[model samples]
Every structure is written in structure tokens, then in C-alpha cells.
Target chain A: MDRQLDQLLSSAGRPALCQSVLPALLGCIADIARTLRTSHTVALAGTANAFGDDQLNVDVAAEKLVRDALAKCPAVVAASSEEDPAERPVRHSRDAGQTAEEASSEQYTVAFDPLDGSSIIAPNWTVGTIVGIWDGASALRQPPAERQVAAVLGVYGPRTTAIVALRVPGAEAACLEVGIGDQDFRFHVIRSRVRFADPPFATRYFAPANLRAAAESPSYMRLITQYVGKKYTLRYSGGLVPDVVHALAKGHGVYVSPVTAASRAKLRRLYELCPIALVVECAGGRAIDPVDGEEILARPLEGCDDRAGLVCGTTDEVDEVKRELLGASLESCR
Target chain B: MDRQLDQLLSSAGRPALCQSVLPALLGCIADIARTLRTSHTVALAGTANAFGDDQLNVDVAAEKLVRDALAKCPAVVAASSEEDPAERPVRHSRDAGQTAEEASSEQYTVAFDPLDGSSIIAPNWTVGTIVGIWDGASALRQPPAERQVAAVLGVYGPRTTAIVALRVPGAEAACLEVGIGDQDFRFHVIRSRVRFADPPFATRYFAPANLRAAAESPSYMRLITQYVGKKYTLRYSGGLVPDVVHALAKGHGVYVSPVTAASRAKLRRLYELCPIALVVECAGGRAIDPVDGEEILARPLEGCDDRAGLVCGTTDEVDEVKRELLGASLESCR
Candidate 1:
């Protein structure tokens, strides 16, 4: 009755490092989900994180849980989180037994956003966790398409579920959706190979984030107007995780978070955007920067605080974004 | 450990009829929540409802459960649902023991949308059940403010919760938010009294339903433009129940569904709109028809197929909806 996450990872031929790191990460997410059900207190801790967003007691608590869980994984040499945007050594004890060079060769680094939608959590709306696992000891100065081997998105909604994407260099890319049961809290595979619906669908959905940016960018406003004019169903929840997850679940959706002068991009590259990009690509969808129309996975991490706008989901819809937001501008110059 | 729904109703000075009827209704909703967790099938039943909306397997299952539960309640004389838009007799067994007049005097009627947001349920997103209890044998030929006494909205999300609104003829209206625990599946009070945030808040939210109508109605389009320009956070989930529930939980939100020449109103009055209107009004918010600027509760429910657009939430924002979508047209005459 219990379909463990490790079994699924091993059967899918994921890297040994991923088989070990992701389960530990999910364990922490499951614990956080349980705590949220009973904890009624969402009082502000009166402190800000590295990003300057005010910290809630639950946010800080979730970050500690994720950090503690990663520290237990021997293969996780270093980790960074949105709450604390610094790559700190996870298992310092390993330095005593092995040389730094030897440890760095085999271990992996993780960057995560422990709690993504703290603003919506107060209303008991869905929130989530995003984790990106890289192949080396550090996740800096390289594009996500290079060393990012795996990613897991933990959705804490009506049901506790995770969408796992694995891309080891030699093996086939795979996307799996799994759910945690309330009775035993065990992960059971829901969809083994998740993919966006093939084109020519009867209906389409859109989640336009950073809506205020519409006032600053005429192109972004045009995109929103186009989606509504085409009779696209709107399904935004004002949370990056749920908005994207909705696309994965429904088999067709486009989520846009545009960067404008008055409204800077809020999603961090290393912690949030890169991880979600991996999942979307593995699902046979596309993820790109809405402004430049470049692949998101091709963008370098640079630092934990690097932020970018994203346009991702089903391939055709994402292509339309480029046509309206990017191509339209190119043609107007003529 | 268990804060039963009956206890909450009795303590709130609700009528004896509500105390007996609401508990039975919640028991049905809780059962539906459990079914949703384990059921993976979202196949179409190959049938359409009275409104021509396709019926999914889960939707049909939920409607049957609600009908069966109401039949077991001796004091529920009749019931109607979105799936079956005709008022039908309940508890016919009472006819054997008592005369028709005796049964009619003490009994109540119920109208419900057994499963609201069925379209979103396929993705495992949060959907809900809405039930409104009326004072007589039929919920017809009367304004909701005159006879509707109580309502319950069962939210099937990461945690099962219900927002109960009770407004007996002479008693103070009460809106209580309660949660159903995993261990016992019993309702416990989360917020004893739920109300919208007072005006002059730092942040505001909006959920604009039926966005397709924007193409036909310039005022509706203008309303959305104004909301985005004013920096209102968009939190729409394309579901009426969760959209309104978000407003109650966040303490400030305006949910608008406007009717136009091309896009008629989709929300049902008896099964969907009235129940939510009662809950929103009890929470110190306002619910009104978007086109006419009339109070939703004041509209007479002529039959089971009644339909109307809703603009409900915090007092000021609902007022703004009236101003932008209605008042602007009035000003144009000058």
C-alpha cells in the first residue's frame, strides 16, 4: 500500500545522489504540512529575511526544518535557502573523514525556498516549497541547465503532493507526481510521467502574476488583455508555486510573472525560478524569461538573490507569450 | 476534543431546526471530502445537468450523498441541488406518522451545490460544498433575507473546514470558521466570529470571475483595469466558493461576477449564490447583483433555475464595484 519515494526514484534510474537527497527533502516538507494544519498562529516575527520580506513565525520554523533535514543527508555538502541566502556547509563532520576535494567531487548542493507563499498562507490558502538539487558542492556561476540534476515541488493544498523532475545527464528526463496520504503520510505515485496536454485543447488557462506590473509595461498589459479576450480561463492564486502547479495538474496552463521598471521581479533564480523551470521542462513544457524570451534554464545562477521574471507552462501558450510580449515590439520598430 | 457543529449552533442561540439540520448536512460534506481524497477518477459521466454543464463522476457522486443525507433528517421537508434543479420532497416517511400540514409547519427546505468548482476538482485543487437552509418546505417565491436562516460552506482543502453563518429571525447574525481535524474528523472552531477587514487597510485583494464577460462589457473591463492600476492583489481561483472563502479568511477581498449580453451569469441563485451571500453578509460584507446594484439577499428566488451575477466582499470594495461597473454608466449620461 505504501509506494515510497525512494522506490520510484530508483526505478526511474535517477542518480544515486537524487535518490538520497529528495526523500529527505520531502520528509521535511511533509512535516511542515502537518504543522500547518494545527497551527493557528500566523503572527509576524517582526523580522525580515535576506530578501527584506517580513518573516512569519511559520516561515522561520519551516526553514529550520528544511535545513535540519538536509544536514542529515551525507551527500548534501552545502545548501542555500531563500530565508538565509548563503551557501553554508551542511555536513561539516565529513571534513574530518575525507579531503575537501574528495568530498566536493561526490556531494551535491541544494537551493530552496522553504515557504513560497507566506502572504497567502494567513488566509489558509495553498502554499508550497521549492527545492533544486545541483550535482556539485556549489550551485553558483553555472546555468541551471548544466548541473541541476533534479527538482521537487511540494504542494500543500487540499492534498499534500509533490511534483518531482529528474534529469541526470545520461538518462531520460522524467516528471512524476506523487501524493502523501493523510493516514500514513507516505508518498504514493500519482502520475509517473507527467506532461502538458498536446496542442488543440478545447480550453486554456492563464495565471498572470505581478499584475501591478501591467501598469508599468504596456506589453504585459497587452498580454493580459489578449488572454482575457481569447476567453482563456483565469486561475491565478497569487502564489508562484500553486499557479505553476495548477498548470501541471490540468495538463494545460500558462503562468506569467513579468519584470517591469516599477515592479521588479520577486522570484529568486537559485531558490525559486530555476527549480520550477526544471519541472516545467521535464513535463515537456517550456520555461523562459518573459522579457528577453530566453530559456530560464540557460540563465546562470550568479547568486542566491538573483531574481528574474518567468513565463512557463504548455509550449504553445508560452510561445504566444513571446509573440505578444517580445515579437510585437520587434515588428513595431519597422 | 470535538467541537461539534450542533454545540456551536446551540450556543450561538440558533433555532432548534438549525441545530438538527446543520449537523446532518455537515456529516454529508465530511463524507464527500473523504471520498475526494482517495478517488482518482475524474471521468466525465457523459451527461449534462439542467444548466448544460457536463457532469463529472465526482460531481454526480457528491450530489447523491447530499441528497441522501438530507433525506435522513426528519425535519427537512424538501431539497434542491444544482445537479437536479427541481425541488423534491424529503423524508416521505413523516407522511405516515403525521399529516401534511403538521410536517410542513415544523420542517425546513435546503438548496445546495453539492460540489462547487467541479471543473477545478480534476486538478486536486480546493473545491467546496455550499448549503443554504430555508424556513419552509420550499425555497421559492420569497427573498432570501425573509426566510433563509443558516448556511454552511465545507472547504475540502489540505484541511477540511467549514464557515457556518447563522441568522435566525430575531437573533444576532453569526459567522464562525471551524476546522475538521484529521484524527477525529470533527469540526472545531477556528475563528469564533469571522468578519471582513475594516476599511483603510494596507493591502486589498480581488477575484474577478467570468473574465470572458470583459470583452462584451466595457465597464467590467474598466473595473479590472482600475483594480490592477490601484495595485490590488489578484487572488482568483476560477471557483466561486474558494474565491469568496478567500475574502472571509483574508478579512478583505472583493469577488465580482458580472453578467453581459454575450456572457450570461453562470452562478445559480438557490444552490450557489444565496448560500454564499448569506455567509458574506454575516461576515460584515455586502453581496449585490453586479448589473442592477441591488442587494443579492433582496432578490426573490422565483424558482430553482434562478441565476445572477454577484459582487460581494468588504463593504468599501463592494461599493467600488457598484461605482465602477454601475455608477460610471450613470455619469456618462451627463
Candidate 2:
């Protein structure tokens, strides 16, 4: 995967942060890739995370692999993950003895969910890795979505594949960074960079209406009913990354999970909402908060653990969500 | 992988029919499995199947492979699949010069869905291959559920794995024929028969209440609403094989799709229902038709193209289906 990015790697104009971050992340891909490749043997740890979701042996092991691999990179100064209760600082590889004042602003903060939807692992369902790249220490104080340098989601299923959405000024919307589809693909967990930055459009047209729609608020339920009445097919696995990525790949499809009566929402802002918002928005689509009536990425970060409802997909589909589901005026929301 | 099956191969009482069919089918596994192991390179053919569902390159290729590879099995006199309009005869490979009278009753019939839920492939959700083994050409006229000798479902996701439920004389009830968590595991696609037939059961419970519930019958809608009200987690992936297999693994859970107004049912009898029904029933679970209150497997064969509503899973879960969803009297249907 690093070969396709040789131009990016050698380019002079690219930001220094991603120049190191992307390649370093490219290196980190192997750890999780190994877990996915050997999925049949990974055991259930017989435990759950802080979120009360079950943890697989692969999930816990992969998270450590990513942290260890990324920590060694001089560019990764700090990292926050759903697996950890708080962010941990990584000592610069080149400046291990330097004080906090000596560390350069060129470093990055990585916020990620090492393994999303871990519950589905045993069933052999599609699960993924999600990461958000932030500029520096100060960038973490604000909603990382606004300053997100890049968003990467690796879906590990029948194939070990990764999608990176880069926000560099001249960068293309999305890149098939570490793909198995390339001619030089290796059988093991090594990187294979194919041609990068082709706008991935949906080959099949169907909105990824989340399965949780049935019990969503009355308005959301009505929206699903309308979609059903209109004959829009469904494409949802229980995983958020795969569901959203499916819509992004197809270039169209709505994925909604509004704040319901029982809870605020299942998706976390830093780990899920922001990173995915960056992905869809960059892919010629929209991601928004239905009730607040604003772009999801544009919203201020409530906290590290903040949650929000999501209605994300193609531009037209989000409009369908706003106008029909939220009962906002059609042309007004559009 | 084949070494684990040494016991089954050397057992003297093993049926003569499976001695050839199982090994041949085992060999055919590579053809379909190659699609998964090399998933990144398999292009999505811009085509749709006869069912109007979009086709993946792997789906079309796998179907032809299973057909071609299984054709040489002397025990397989004929094969039918969801991909084909009708049953296709398989000439005996070793006795090509012999007349039809020379072929003994040893010949068996096979009905299969070479690829199920092909649309979910691009998004990288779990899809599967389903096979049902029958006695002979004359037995094909009988309800497949009643006479099914062996039922096999191969799930291709993070791992290429299969589950087999055998009704052969002296064969165990439910066997983990091919498993990933075993010792002496290899990296290839080979059978690693686990503990044989011990009446597999559901562990983590969740019904695959598909999104079409809103458009389904009022009673079905209410059933979903009640399940949601009670906070029953969902396990459906819009794939029948994965959903059903999840229930079978956990020991109990229901997967039902009654005839909606706009369609008859999603599962076709010959390809999907009969095969899966035989598997679940053989596993000590129940597969029933809620409307008339009969075993789903006991229903007579309508035709090669016939379809039906499904209420399949564990006995109690299926009972909840009959009592709540179908409004059937308690114990009367059982």
C-alpha cells in the first residue's frame, strides 16, 4: 500500500503530520490484519468493555498491537482509543529524552476504535478498525472532526481491506490504501498499495437503513416505514463501520441512528460520529445531526465520550432524513 | 484438515453414498473458498441474477464450480440449484459407457444454493453456501425436509467454515464438522470434523428480525415491537444463512419471515428452506410453517420453483413464533 503513496511520500507540498502519520499507520495495518487473517483461532475473552460490549481475544490483542506499533512512530505523540478509559501520551521515538516543551507541533493525536463491533466476531460477521487523525495536542481540545487530517476504516471480513479518507488540500477524497485487489497482493498480512484516490461510487443502490430503526423514535420509525413503503432495499450488518462504508462504497444509501427514548445514542462522537462524518462528507455525501439540524462534523465536541444521533449518507438521502424523518421543512433543510 | 476426518472415512458402517459425495463436496469447497480467501481480487460482475438480485463475480463463478466439480461424483445422479431453472443430470464419471440400468440405487440427489445473499458481498458482510443431500431421483419427488439425509451450510466471512447436520444411519445428530478453533489446524480450506452430533444449541440469543417487519403482517409487526420493547438484541445481517446459523449456534432463537403482501417469501423451497429446515430439525431444533401448523420439512414438495413463509430455529423460540406471531393455540401446533 505504501508504493501507491510514493508520490505522496516524496511530495514536498504535503503537510508534515500525515507524511509520517499515513506511512506509520500503513505500518500499523499488519497487526490487525494478522488478527483478521487468523480469525478462526481468536477466542472470546469472556469479558466486556466499559461500553458493556463483549470483548474478543482478537479485539484486545489487536488494540495492543496497534498501540505498540503506532507508539514507536515519532509522529504519533498521543493516542486515545475506545479500549482505553483515557488518552495516553507516546514518547517521541527520536526525542525520547526531551521535555513536553521540546516535542514538535508536527506530531499527531490518533483517536481510534481498534476493533468496532467486537460482538459480531464469533459469528464471523464483518467487523472493522476506525481511526481519526488529529493535527496536534491542541487539536484534541476541539472536535477532531473539524481538524481531522484523515479518517481510516479497515473492514476485515472475507478479505482484509482498508479505506482512508484524506483531507489534505490536494488529496483525493478516498484511497484504497491497503487493498487486496491489487496485482502485487501478498498472501500474508503485508501491505499492498493499489492505485489510490478514485471516487468509490456505489455499484448497487440500496440505503443501509440500520436495523435499530424499528425501535427508534416515532419519527424515525415513520421514516423507515416510508422507506419500506417505497421499496428501498436494506443493507445492514450490525457493525457501524461496515454499514456506513457500504453506503460510501455504493456512493449512496442512508444510515440513521437517532437518539431514542431509551438512550442518547449508541455511536460515540470522537470514535464514530466525527471520523465517519469526515469520510462521507469527503465522498460527496453528507453527515448530520437530525435534531440539532447541523452538520455532524461541524458540531463542537461535547466531550471525549460525547454521543449523538446520526443520519448520514448521500446528499439526497440525508435530505430525505431531515425532511421526512425530522419533519423539518423539505426545501428549508435542503 | 482431511486428517481429522480419518475416523469418518475409515468407519465401516458409513453409508456408501456419503463415502463419495462428502469427499467430492469437500473437494468442491476449494472452488468456492478460493473466492473468499482471494476476495480482494474477485471483481464484481456488473450483472443481476434470475432473481433480480445483483450478482458478484464470485457468486456466478462459485455456482458453476460447485456444479462442475460435483458432476463427476458417481454418487450424485442429479443436481439442482437456485441458480438454475431446473435440475441438471450428472452423468457417472467412471461408468460413462454403462447404461442407466447399470447405475444402482447408490446414486443420490442434491439440492443446493451455491451462493446465498450475494448482494452483501461488496460490503463484506457474511454470505454462505447451502447444500441438501437427498436419497435418489425418486426421493426428489418427496418433500426434501422429510427425506433429507445430510444438510451442510458453509459460512464464508472472516473464516471459511462449514457446519453439517447428518441424518445418516448411526451418524451423530449435530456435528461441528469443520471448525477453526481446533488444534492441528492448517491454513487451507479443508474439513476438520469436530465432536459429532450432540444436538447443537443456541448460546447468545437474538432473533434476526429483518427490516421488512414494518411492511409485514400486523401480527408480525407487533411481534417485533414486543421484542424491541423487551430489549431483545438483533442479530440479522440480511443474510438467511448467517442469521439461521447464528440461532443454531446459540442453541435457540427464531428467524421468521411470514408471507408479506408484496411477496410470497424470500426463501425458495428447493434451494433454501428445505436444506436449512433439514439442518435445524436434525440439530434437535424445529422448522415449522406457522400458518397451517406443520413441520416446515414435512410440507410436500410444491415444485422445483415453489416458495414458502419460514418459522425456523429452536423449539421454544419457534413455539413463540407459532403462539405469538401466528396466533396459534398453545401445544395444539406442537
Candidate 3:
């Protein structure tokens, strides 16, 4: 039965690639989730967050699961992120002419933005885990400037979805499309959050983006301001993984590029969320070019690389952000 | 030095008391504090708290520490709380009621509130932890309601303090009181958060008798209120252990006892903070007794135990409350 279930989920993502490892990933994810649930539910009376630090408060089992996976898969050279720099193999002292055996072994590096938007843990906000795999040999040889990534994947809960991006032939040619919302993710396109054709746009706006881009986009800015004025709910997570996870789950998204804002600069990414974009696209959604649709944007090295505006929803809704970028005047959906 | 520190901490409390096991408790506290400082040094990535949840995110080190202590202490009967209900032995049980030689051993049951206020993990709130030690034999008995605890202890940090309670005698009650701001504390009088210059004066004001007591006793209330609010930064741990620890560190204090509008019941204790009042008094903090300063009040299981409006804090403040309850106007202290 276990083998059959594995075959089913594996078959769900065809071509017998790493998808064959779906069962293993799922098992790890489940183990971590259950461990986390138990820990929180039964934490000692006064003990909170498990550790005094906020980042360490993340699912301890989640970190262990990732660590275990990395250790077992000799294919993995490094498995860690801003949340965990400990996973980086320590370099033995060469000053003393240390032998090769004395030096730590190099393995595949799995860089991650672990538990992005974890600040929402207190209020139970949407959070996510993302891992980007880079080639061990190349990663070690290249300077900080030249690390190329092979694959990136992420998962989120409430309704767990596993999104992956593989650098296969015909991949990374264009701006990625994004698909989010509902279990039945049959993809469709729409222009923007506002639709002169759909039900009047009456909900509050809550996406993590640069305040500057949000202000520049007249439609989104007006909606956001009005929503804030009405004292409607607005939550912005400066972290990328969680922000995007939330946007997809909710069906309508908004992100501004070239933010020119200090606060939003932290959300910039080079090679990360693109794979997530691939997953979104596969699900029949669109990730519009933050800039001109014609010129494919390269991941920025220093800062705000993918800061171009991002809006994902049904294909048509996201097109609105694209339309606005293209000098297209949009009628208010309301 | 480690042994000396342990001996110094264990001196006043019962030698076999759970609180006497100061090594693990203090070690975990320092570990948490250090982690918090390191993680929060830069722009904090996410919310973290001092405590860890056992059910949601188990801390292997913490579990091992508590388990080791429970095993070494025979005086402990059955410990139970948010972490575990059954009295798991320090050693594993044999399978299916078989002797150890006959089958694989079963896991021991250890009940602990590994880390409380776990909700703080997400929003970056102050968290604390508690562990109540009981004998395994007693734990194997019936319901938790039937078990009698020998000692309950707690640690709350970022203003580190150890608060304890024990049923044993000749135990010079002590509290690890690290004065906030000043960072110096020793055994001292308890204090309150609400006070009134005179009683009966505010009979028409706040609903409960306790609030009225504060309104009535002007000078005493002022001292208690200021100490309660400014001293602890108005932090409340729904978890009993941290709250008790915080109170102990500040010479003892009180939260507003929840009172319904219609029932003019004199306040005996604050809502969630009530359960630990006995433990607080046992630790040498005064549990306000309207009629007496030294006595601790508990509701009679049967009949009208309706003693309303007690005071809790440093013994001095409690005495002050007792004086007011006797209808004497407070005398000014130089």
C-alpha cells in the first residue's frame, strides 16, 4: 500500500525525475509537521518557542528532518540557509597544513529561506519553507558571485502544495507564470485584482511589496489606501517565500518592483522563487514580467533583482498588472 | 564552580526538591537567553520566545534534562501537565505488562509544561517554562486530580529568576529575584499591581472587591500598582510558571482578577493567575488575605469560602493590604 501510494503521488508529477523521491520528501515533511504539532501542544508549562531566539523557534523537527536528509543524501554538499548557517561544513585550518581527511567533506549545498514569514507564528499567519539546491563542486569553486542553482522547491500548509522548478531544457526562457488558489488548480488568466466584469472588488488588500511600487501603481495603491482607510485588514510580510505562498493561496496577488524602499529591499531574490513560478504556471497561472514582458529579467546579484512587480491569480487577473506595466489604462473592476 | 553554583542554588529549598536541580534549569535558561541575543542582534528574522513547546516542537536537550532529574529523584510521585498526562517512568516500560527481561521496555511518562507561552514564538513575546516533579508511583495512580505535588518550580528569563514552592519544612523560602533594571535581587517583600488609599471609598467604582480595595487603599495601592506595571513591563504569561517567576523576581504582584458585572464577589484571586497563588505564597510571596497578612487563602471545597479581595506581593505589601482590610488608613513610610 505504501509503495502504491508512492507510485500514485510520483506518477502525479510525470517523467520519473526526482519526483520519484516525492514519497521521501512527503514523509519528511509529514514527520516534521507532526513533531512540530506535538511539541507546541505539549511544551512544558513555561517553556515557549523551544528556544529563546525567534529563528530557532521554528519547527525544530523541520530543521532536523532537512539535516537528516542532507546527511543521508551524499549528493547534498551543503544544506542550510539564513535560518541555519550551521549546516555549512566548517573548513579545517589550512594554516597548519591540515590533511584532506582533516578537512570537512564537501557535499551538495541546499540553500534555503527556511520558514519565511515565521513572525506570523504568533497570530498564525501563512508561513513557508523553501530550499534551493546548488551544485556542490561548482558552488565551492565559484566565488560568491558565480553560484548557479540547479533546482528550487518550496512547500506550504493549510493546504499543502509542493512546487518545484527544474532547470531542464526549455526552462528559464521567460518570466515565470504563477498559479494559486483552490484545490482544483485548473489554471486560468485574469487581468488584475480589479475586474470591471467580476464581483465588485470589495476585499482589503494585503500583499508584501514595496510601498513605493504599490503607490506607483495607481489602481493597486488606491485600493490599498482605501482599504487601510476603511480599517480593513492588511498584513505584509517582508519575507518572500511566505508572501508569495500567501498570495497564491488567496487567488489574487500584488507585488511592486523597483521598490526603491529600504523596507522592501529584503524581498529581492535572484534564482529563488522562479521555480515556484514554474509550479504556478504548471497549475495554469501566470507570473508576469515585473518589467516589460518582452525582455526576460535576469536574477539580480546584489539587490532587488526580481523586484519587478509581481501579480498572480487566475491568468486574466494577473494580466492586469502586466497590462498596467504596458501603458494600458485599466478600468476599475468594481 | 559548577558544583558550587548548584549547591548555592539548592541551599534554601528542599534538598530533593525539583527546584533544587538548578543545573539543568539554569543551563536551559542561559542557553535560551544566549540564543535570543545572537538571533536578535541584527534585524530580527522572525519572532522567537524563551520557551519551547514539547508537543509542537520538542527540544531533545530539554526533555533529556527533565527526564534525568525525574529518574534521579525518588520523592517525585506522578508528574502531569500539558506535556504528558501519564506518569511515564524515567525508564521505558516492558511491553504488554511483561517484565523487562521478557519484552522490550516501554517509554517513561514525564509530564511537563516544557515551555509555556509558546504562542510567543510567532509574535516574539516573552515566554517561560515549568516542570512539576512527582514520584512515578503516585503518577501511576488514578486521575491527576488525585495526585499531590511535592514541588513545582519555574524559570523566566531576559530578567532571569527562579521561583519555587515546596511542601517540605525548614525550607527557608527563597526566590531567585534578579531585580529588573538594577539586576540585583534577594529574598524580599511581595507587591501588588492595584492599590487604593482607602477601602469602601471606591465601593461605587470598579466592580470587584479587589479593585475596590485598591481604590480604597491609596498609598499602598500606588506602591503596588507601580511595581506591578513598571517593574515587569506588564507582561503576563498565561503559563503559570513564568507568571510566578516574574512575580517572585519583582517581590510578587497581581493581575486584574476578572470580575463579571453582576456578581459583586470580592476578588479572592485574579483569573488565570489564581492557580499558582498557593505556589507563590509557598515561595514566600504573600497571597493577599483580606483579614490577615501572613495567611494564604484557598476556597473551601464545600460551603461559603467566599473570602473576597485578598492581596499578594512582598510580605510587606500584603501586610499593608491586611491593615487596610482592617479599616485602618495607611501610615506613610519614610
Candidate 4:
């Protein structure tokens, strides 16, 4: 059941590493989710993810299934999981026959939130997995979110799906790459919208916020009231992945997490925000910090625990969040 | 296939008409939902329901399927649908061999809201079908909501489900059925929670409200703010069927529709509120009118076009809505 992560990746001199890992990652996630769906028991596992959030037994199993599968892959150099409690990242061994040259060139850093929102699985609400792939072991030297070269969201509900995005633009395009350094990563989505119908949704726009937390603050409360006043609908499922991907499939709406006095950021920057922001931004949508308007994917990964409120989705809604939550003027918000 | 509705009845005037229609109606709804789910086109049908609401093609097809099926049923002497724009209710013919004496005793009335909230199919959010069955073709004689004898909710999402309920108790009990008349209709749920996880969702309460509409008034704004302040989650899919069903499945949480000045009520009392309220109440949950503290199913279906603000879900959350929105005392609201 375990596949070496590195063997699935291509060397730097060869094709893109994302090409090999994409399908493998998607397969691993789907295989695990499908198996869990058939099991009648979906209760809490008395376990939690790295951030101490309670994990469902199904989620704990899905996390292990993915961690073990990726950890066995030779291409996966350093791996971090939302469910893994270990302080040091898990580093997989190179394949038996791999030469040092091949090992160094093909190695990848893989970070993932194995079962995002597994709690919803009980009532069979839509749930998903989110993964971020970075080039080489450097994913460890600096913050992992900043180093992510690819991110994918896999949703399993009424229909199964793998929404994939890759940074494939070559060195020639230096514009968006400056944020990611010399990697010259450009936004490119490989797949999207599994079983969801194509867009033409009259007024479906997602605004993911903590209602209780929002009400405590006047500014955040204003943003929420304004969204409702505009007659905008929401898709806040208490899970980050499903909310973001729902909007992604519809090609509209915004998913936001605003900072409140009690909680600086509820979503993990690397496991939650980075992958979603990358997918959204690549889909002709916008992903930015609610505070400074910096690209969400480019937010400096200050540390493993670094967190910043994020707003992601279509330009219109994100623009609204920027103006309302951050007080960015309409002129400068977009 | 259209089955004559009358032949299914006992004709002996056994208990009531609901007993005969419950099984047939559930079968009809389940059949139509399952068929629509497999169709390739999940897009909008470019048509709308009677309320001037947009209809998904799946919904349009589902509506036709239910109307046609019920029309052939002999037990269903009179039938009306949310999608049918006709002036007269469709009437099913009596069995070919039936005499006038038997026909008079066997006939029943059935009203349905087929394909409730089909628009969310674009994003594949949970959607459902609701049906309310009443005795006598005279269902047209009174507001169909007040005439309901039995009801069902069919949810089509990660799974297909059939939830049925009947008023088995005699009318002598004034505690729960004053709204349905001396018919002594009792509360009961046939089936429920096709895929939703069991209760104890920590804080997974779904408070479905019309945010924009709520904000138009001060009282509604206060209620919504209080919900947020109390840290309530939401599942407002702009569809009464799915939101109410979601809460029903979770076995906890609350779903509400408070009165607004501009709009009397958003959900149809006859087709939507009555059916869902029946299911939730039968499941050990509660459904009530935020204004008068009357049971939702007990609301006199004022007329065909009657709509009302509703609140339903687990006891605690609903009690909160009654107290905050309707100013009901702790003991009086319950």
C-alpha cells in the first residue's frame, strides 16, 4: 500500500516532479476515502492532528494511510501531515537503486491535511483532502507554504473529485514567480469540478467566516452583514477544503477566514490556506491576505505555526472582503 | 409508471387516508429522485417553479416525474405540485372497476414540492424532495398545509433517502396537533438521515436564516447576532428542504426563518415547512413558528400561496430562537 514519494517525482533535469506526484497523490487520497465511506462507524478516534484539533477515526486512518504511502515513496524527501504529531518532519528513504544524483534532483517536500473536515463525514456531508507539494528538501529550510510548487484538493461527496493545480510557467515569466523566488512558478490547473455541475449559478457566492467570532468584532460583523445585505449566498461547511473547492467548481464566490481578538488564525497556513489559495488564484480567482493584500500563496511562511487571515475566491467577493474587513479602498483593493 | 391511487386505500375508512398514501408517496418520491440523479444533465432547465423561482433541469424533470406518477395513482384523487403552474389541481382517475361508493371512500389528496432547492445542484450541495398527503380531494378545500395527514422528505446528495411521517394519534390530544384540526393527526417520521452522521457534533448546529432579509429589521438582526454570539454554525443553502434535512440528520442544531417586514415568509407552509417539521418533530426534535410559538406543522395552511417563518432542529437551539425572536418565556415557548 506504500509507494515511495520520490519515485513518483521527476528529476530537475527531466519533466516536472508535480506531473508524477499529482496522480499518485490523488489516487492515495481517493483510495482511502472510498474505503472509509463503506465503513459504518465514523466516530471520533480519540486522536488529533498536529495542531491539536480533534480528528475523526476515519480521518486518523486516512491520515495514516496517506502518511505511510507517501513516506514510503523515495521522491518524497520531507513530509509533514496535519495529523502527524512528530516535531521533526518525516523523511523517506531514497529508492534502493537511486544514485545520489537522481535522489538530489528528484526529491520533494510533501505537506498535507489528510482529511480536511472529516467530522462532516458522519452525516455524509461533502468532505475533502488538501496537499501541497514543494521542490527538493528546501521545503524544510524555509517555511513550507512559501516553497509549495503544487497543491491539490480532493473532494468526496455526491461525487468524487481531484482538483489539481501546478506552477508550470517556465523561467520566462518572472512576474508571478518573484513571490516564489527564482522557481519561476506560474499558475496552471490540471483538473477541476469532479461531479459538480458547470457554473451558471444565479447568486451562489461563498463567504466562509466564524459567525460567532465575527459577531464579537464590529468590523467583522459589518463585513458579514454587508455580504448578506447584498443577497449573496454562502457555503460555510465548517471545513476549509470543501468550502474553497465548492467555490472553485462553481468558478465564483469567496472563502474567507478573518482574524479576531481571540483567535489570530484558525486555519493552518501551510496545510489549509496555501493549497487553497494556490488553486483559487490559478483558477482566475484571487487569494490575498485580509490585512496587507499580499497574494495568499506568497504570504511569508514566518514559521511552522505562522498564520494569517485569508480571503479567496472570485475577484468580486474577495474584493469586497479586502475593502470591508481590511478597509482597503475600492480603488486599491482589486 | 402512474399507478391509480385509489386502489391502494382500504376503503373501509380504517384509520385515515395517510396510511394508504404514505408508502405509495414515499416510493414515488424515491423513484423520481433516484432517476434524476443518474441523468447526465444536472444543469438548469431554463424554467422556474410556480413561485417564480429558478428550476434546475433535474428539478424540472423530477417535477414532471412526480406529477405524472401521482396523477396515475387512484388513491391520489387530487394532486397539486410546486412546479405545476396550472389553475386546477390534477386529479387521478378512480380504478376502472371501482363503484362510486368505493371511489368516495378510497380517494385522497396529495400535495408536493418536488425538487426543492435544485439550484444548489450546480455545486452539488445537499438538495431534496418533500411531499404532504391529506385525506379527501377537498385538500383543495382548505390550505393544503393544514390538511396534511402524512409527509416525506427525499434527500439526494452523497446518498438517496426517503423520510416518512404520519399523524397516527387521535385528535383528542391538544398538546401537538391543534393546527391540523380535530383529525387528531399525530407526529411520526417514516425515514431520515440518509447519509448524515449521528448527533454529538460538538457544536455542529445548522441555523438557516435569510441573512439579507434578517438584516432589514432590527429584531431579526438581534436574533442572528445572538446566534453568532452564541457560536452557532449555519447551513443556509437557500433551500428549506436541504437545510432542514441536514439539521434533522445531525440530530442537533437549529434551522430558522424569522419574519421580515418586506416578505411575510420565504418557505411555503403547505409543501416545505409542514413536511420538514413533521420529520424533525418525529425524530425527537422540535419545529415551531418563531412568532406565535405554534408547531410548524400545526400552522393553519392559510391558502395555497401561504408561507411562514419557521424554526426547527434540536430542542435547545430552537428554544433559543423562540425566546430571542418571539419573546417566548422559557416555560411558555416549550
Using DockQ, give the best candidate's number: 1
Error of 1 at B332 (Å): 8.9
Mind giving the per-residue lDDT tens digits that candidate 1 earns over A109-137?
Answer: 99999888876664556778999999887
Q: Estimate the TM-score for candidate 4.
A: 0.72
| A123: Cα error in model 4, Å | 3.4
Q: Tell me the number of clashing residue pairs for each predicted model.
A: 3, 11, 97, 30
Over A1-334, each residue of candidate 2 has an lDDT whose tens digit, in order, gives 3444555433424444445556555555545755565555442221112223335456677788777767556667778888774667875554334334234556677888888877666556778888887767633457555577688887776556666676654555444434443123332222222221233432323443334545656676667557665656666566888787676544457777766565556688888888888877766678898666589887666567877888887777787778765664444567
**Candidates ranked by lDDT, best first?**
1, 2, 4, 3
Q: Any runs in candidate 1 off by more than 4 Å, and if so which? A: A1-8, A11-15, A41-55, A92-106, A328-334, B1-8, B41-55, B92-106, B328-334
Which of the two, 2 or 4, has more lDDT? 2
- Chain A TM-score per model, please list them: 0.90, 0.80, 0.55, 0.76
List per-prediction Cα lDDT, in the order shown: 0.78, 0.63, 0.37, 0.58
Error of 2 at A261 (Å): 4.8
Tens digits of per-residue lDDT for model 3, A1-334: 1333333333322222232222234445444433432232222211232323643645454666655544444344445454444346523222333234223432345555545544333222224556655445323234322233333333332222333433333333111212122223221111112111232334323442544344345544454344333433233444455445434433334433323233243442333443344434534455555444421123322321333445443455456445655444233432
Which prediction has the highest lDDT against the true structure?
1
Weakest lDDT window of 10 consecutive positions for candidate 2 chain A = A43-52
A best-first ranking of the candidates according to their DockQ comes to 1, 2, 4, 3
Sort the candidates on TM-score, descending order. Answer: 1, 2, 4, 3
TM-score of 3: 0.36
Score chain A of model 3 by TM-score against the reference chain A.
0.55
lDDT, residue B322, candidate 1:
94
